[model samples]
Target: MPTARESLLNAALMALAQLPWSGVRMVDVASAAGVSRQTLYNEFGSKDGLARGLARREADTYLHGVDRLLAERTGAADRLVAIAEWTVGEARAKPLLRALLTGCWSERLPVPRPARRGAVLSKAPAQRRADAGLPSPADLVAAVRDRSLAALEKGSRPSRTKEESAELAHRSEQAVRLALSYVIAPVGEGVGPLVRTAVGGAVGTTVSATVSATSPTAADRRRLQSPV
Candidate 1:
């Protein structure tokens, strides 16, 4: 069963779907959640608090998805490619997520702000968390990078040297940054090939072999051989 907090957040999201944030009233959200208006207020002190809650949820959900996708048993480059592709798709589908990732909030979004300093804390733990402020686009990129690096390193061979480990982390960040760029600009088609190229080719290849010349794709050949 969904908790009252979850129910209320869902109600608010439903309301958001129907109207802009400015048009969404607390009373209506409580009514939609089948909770009292006071209960709604109790969970979230104000509309801004509710917005923080929603943004917190969006960020948590995105990171959790990244964790799950990274857990998949695949080659390292392939794993990075998978998460990059997923990030683009997810950012497109979720408004709060897109705002969180790209730091580009539309008028429809609440654009969460942290709680006022020296203010009384919310009795709700979740609300306190929301009050802490949401991560920026750069913060999220670093998070994705760290998470990707950890996952890739964990699955890698035990004999890896410090330099190789550092290289792995670098490639992971490289892939994540590329994904963020795509999220911001959104080049046509998928983001997979570019991400794969950034992280090097194939699953089993080492970082030393990255930007591989053994068998470059036609496009890779063009890019490498280009004088411009």
Candidate 2:
């Protein structure tokens, strides 16, 4: 069973699918989750806290998928490509993910407006307390990049020296940044191919050689090469 926090977050997401974030009410979310309004406030502090918690939960879901690919996929390049593909795919499918990743809100994801004077605004004190738990967008991005780099290093061939390990880590960070740039704005090419090129260039390897060494079948290659 989902915890109260999880229930609230899921309710928020469901609300997001139906209405813009700005239009979602804490009371509505609490009711949808079958929890008291006070329980919601206790868990998330404020609307901002709930928004941040939702973003964190979604980011965790995406990163968990990336981690699974890192563990199951062979070769650094292959894993990097897979991660990029997943990121692009999720961002395309989920407006909230796209906004969180790009820091830009589209029509599908209007910015959250402040609540007008009413019962909602009356709960300002509790909301202010919870707002402290929210992480900045930059913090969220940095956390994802750091985790990705660590996964790359763990799966990489053992470095001969500390300097080599550091270099590989740096390259991994660069690979993630390059992929994110494309995620923010595409260049009329498939995400997988673009990511493959970026990762290959960063690590000084050929994409084909990386894929072949991993022994991914035709279907797997097709899946990677196809646009998200």
* Top-scoring candidate (TM-score): 1
Task: Locate the minimum summed-lDDT window of 10 residues in model 2.
Answer: 207-216
Cα lDDT computed for each candidate against the true fold: 0.84, 0.66
Q: Note the clash tally of each candidate.
A: 0, 1
CA error at residue 174 for candidate 1, angstroms: 1.7
lDDT of 1 at 187: 77
Alpha carbon deviation, residue 209, candidate 1 (Å)? 4.8
Model 2: per-residue Cα lDDT over 1-228, one tens digit each: 998888888999999899877799999999999999999987766786687667666666766777787778876677767777777777878887777777787765534443333423324343443333434456555666566667656644553344444444454555556666877776777666666665564456743334333333544666899999
Assess candidate 1 and give its TM-score to the true structure: 0.87
> Can you write out model 1's per-residue Cα lDDT over 92-154, one digit (the tens) per residue?
888889889888899998988789999788899999988988899889888988998788777
Error of 1 at 5 (Å): 0.6
State how far residue 27 of model 2 sits from its true place (Å): 1.9
Name the top lDDT candidate.
Answer: 1
